[model samples]
Target: MDKKRIILNIVVVCLILFSLYILQNLLMPKYVSAIVEGSLIEEYYNEKADYNHDIIFIGDCEVYESFSPISLWKNYGITSYIRGSAQQLIWQSYYLLEETLKYETPEIVVFNVLAMQYNEPQKEAYNRLTLDGMRMSASKIRAVKASMMEDERLIDYIFPILRYHSRWNELTSEDFKYVFKKDKLFHNGYYMRVDVKPVTSIPRGRKLANYQFGDTAYLYLDKITKLCKDNGIELVLVKVPSIYPVWYDQWEQQIEDYASKNDLLYINFLELIDEVGIDYSKDTYDAGLHMNLTGAEKLSLYLGDVLTKTYDLTDKRTNKEYQEIWQEKIDFYEQMKAQQYYELEKYGYLKSFGAKAPED
Candidate 1:
């Protein structure tokens, strides 16, 4: 009777653990529908085993929406991934870089500079979108500590169900379908938008008493440089040509100065817009804030040339193994592009293709 009771207790514990795992899986955001940026970070884990890319882009929405790895591969044979999110702050980027180094070390790390303007944590929602997907690691723990708003607790990140259990009422069919798995929504972390929203009015940067980046921002920037140097990875700083939230002359000068001082390469795409052949009227999807597929491809082509020539990155287009992988990516890219065009034609705007604003 004692042995039987002990066996029953062991079974009960296993069952309880399994049930909690299922519940945690179900409660977490699927990120299949409205807010898909949340899905980007986790997607990296899925690809980690399959390939070791040559380049890794670390930044915010600008990097994901602006750079097309598919295009880069096709046009220049460069393999890359973007670990990006909405409003990804400086410290968050630093932690993310640290976490990424645990997986594979790439030859180059391209960091977007817009995030430098924000020295502190932003919002809990944005933090979750970026950090929740990161696998449990020392880097993730540091990211959670650095990114959490005052109202958030670290325990909530450790046990996500504690934070998302309230989502029981919000669960949809997607929750059940994607409970254990999710569809890949990005091409090597590039969020594609084929629809075009022409630039009308660009927002001017607000007048600031001090245009200098905060000390905290500089601290992480220095950390990023040092970390890359230690790893023998080239750190290339870039300011994507997002016309809004204006990239000021002061900011440009500061980044330029820092790059010169550190002997690092800094490329501001805003200065190369015309040279890159980006047409503002069609290149941007949500006005000039982010690029559409066309813009990304164009930019990727230009950057691919730079990487190939400057860094001497090999052209792997002829490699059979890489060809096999990229062929699937190419097919998916074309299919997505065609689908977006179809949706645009049918509804006069993209329906499920991450439209900035739904058409009336």
Candidate 2:
């Protein structure tokens, strides 16, 4: 064979290999879906194009686990969605909201403040930044334009691959499926039930001496607060309930002071733990760190009531489209609840096969 013929054959083989790789990705399961699962904000904006809601909750897993959009719909007729990330920091929350506002204008924006205290730089934050950049659309460009820093935004927009390069090896066939199969993506906008055991002592002693807010997070928080105020949106900062041991600390006071100084509505559930009916011994999902499904349900109901009474949040569940969406969410929640019960029973945590109680 001549040189040119050999080159052509090699090119053809390369193309065929690439095609096979793409096909495999499309046919796999979705184990790595959690990574992009948090990217639902981008997906929601991209898919729906034009959307609006009365309330939008943004934060880390606490937001997803604690706030049930379906519960909001069922109780208050509020059409809402949770734009939360796993271990999301303040910077990520700001960008997520910035991206979201491009397609939707929510009347109320609630931020879960648990992760706000986290000052350490995490790889996940960078990964999320890159994903958002990769998923940027015309809407995203406009959102970024309205943002504060051009250089930082450009860093993420241009080099998303660099941020998540470490995740390449972590990707499995399931992750490929999650990316290729649109249906496999979490559309219900809720999280699964997580069981927590009780702890005798709250892990303490580790403290960051000079934990100052990064310019990115601080700037975004100020901008976000102003953006909401300018648009007549109510911005509420809520510290979700965790077990007593984990929740108590000097930092709690610091957070409360910050919220008060800003004139922001800060709801610290720590004081109302008894009022919220949280039995750390039984309500926590993972000892004293977080709440389980049982805990989440109790918190959700409490939040729904608090939001209804505090804000003029209008319920949009009467709309046929919202009603249909909410029904699907309810079904998904039931399935997740059943699975949690099964796990709890299997572990011998419960006697009657009901919800798992937080163990000590």
Candidate 3:
């Protein structure tokens, strides 16, 4: 009788645990449909184990939207991945680099400088978009603690069900369809857009009381630099040719000075616009905030030249195994581009192509 009682108790506990798991999966945002950028961080984990990319990009929308890893591969044979999120902060980038080093140390770590403008946590929504997808680890825990706003809680992250359980009322078929799995959303962490939206007007950056990056921002940057140095990874600082949230002259001087002092390479794409053959008239998707496919390819071509020339990085184009892997990537990249173009031709505007940055 006692053995039977013990077996019954075990069955009951297993049932409860299984139910909790289902509920949690159902309540969490699937990010397979609208607002798809949230899936970017999580998709990194899905990359095949052999993705020992030579370069890794860390920052926000700028890096992901500006450069195409496919373009880099096709042109320069550089294997790279962009670990970016919308409005990703400096500390977030630092912790991502830390986590990435644990998995594989790349030859170069490219960090977008736009995030340096933000000194403190900005919003919970942005925080969730970035952190929610990160697999649990010491780096993720530290990232959450460093990134949480005043009203946010670490427990909420540990058990997303606590925060998202209320979403039961908002659940849809997509929630269930993607609860256990998500549609592959990005190619090598690169978001693709074939449609072109001309840059009509760019609001100028407001004059700031101070142009110097905050202490906390610099502190983490120092950590990032040191971390790379300790791991023998070259850290490259880049400013994408985004016209808004102005990359001020003061800010440029500071980054230039920092790079010079640290012996780091800093590329300000804004200055290389004409050289890169970027036409603001059509190369941008939303005004000058982000690049469309045309602009991204142009920038990638120019940057690829610089990276290969400077680093003397191997051209994996001739490599048999890399050819097999990137051929798959190329096929997927072409498929997505063709799909976006078809969507534009049929609908006259992109309907389900991920996200557009909110007005600043």
Model 2 Cα lDDT, one tens digit per residue, 1-360:
999999999999999978755644443323233344444554454334245777788877777766666666777787777777566667567766776776678888988777655544455343343245325565345433433242445454434443345566666665665565454233335554555676566666455664554555656578778878887788888888764334445656756776777778878887788888888887765665667666766777788788889888767767777677667767866765676577666875543323344556
lDDT of each: 0.91, 0.63, 0.89
What does the lDDT read for residue 277 in candidate 3?
96
Clashes per model (N, Cα, C within 3 A):
0, 10, 0
Best by lDDT: 1
Please tell me which model should have the higher TM-score, number 2 or number 3: 3
Cα error, residue 357 of model 1, in Å, equals 5.6
Q: Which sections of candidate 3 miss by over 4 Å?
A: 1-4, 354-360
What are the runs in model 2 whose C-alpha is more than 4 Å off? 1-51, 118-120, 124-134, 137-172, 182-188, 194-196, 205-208, 211-216, 243-250, 343-360
Model 1 scores what on Cα lDDT? 0.91
Tens digits of per-residue lDDT for model 1, 128-150: 99999999999999999988888
TM-score of structure candidate 3:
0.96
Q: Sorted by lDDT, highest first, which candidate order results?
A: 1, 3, 2
Alpha-carbon deviation at 247 in model 3, angstroms: 1.0
TM-score of each: 0.97, 0.72, 0.96
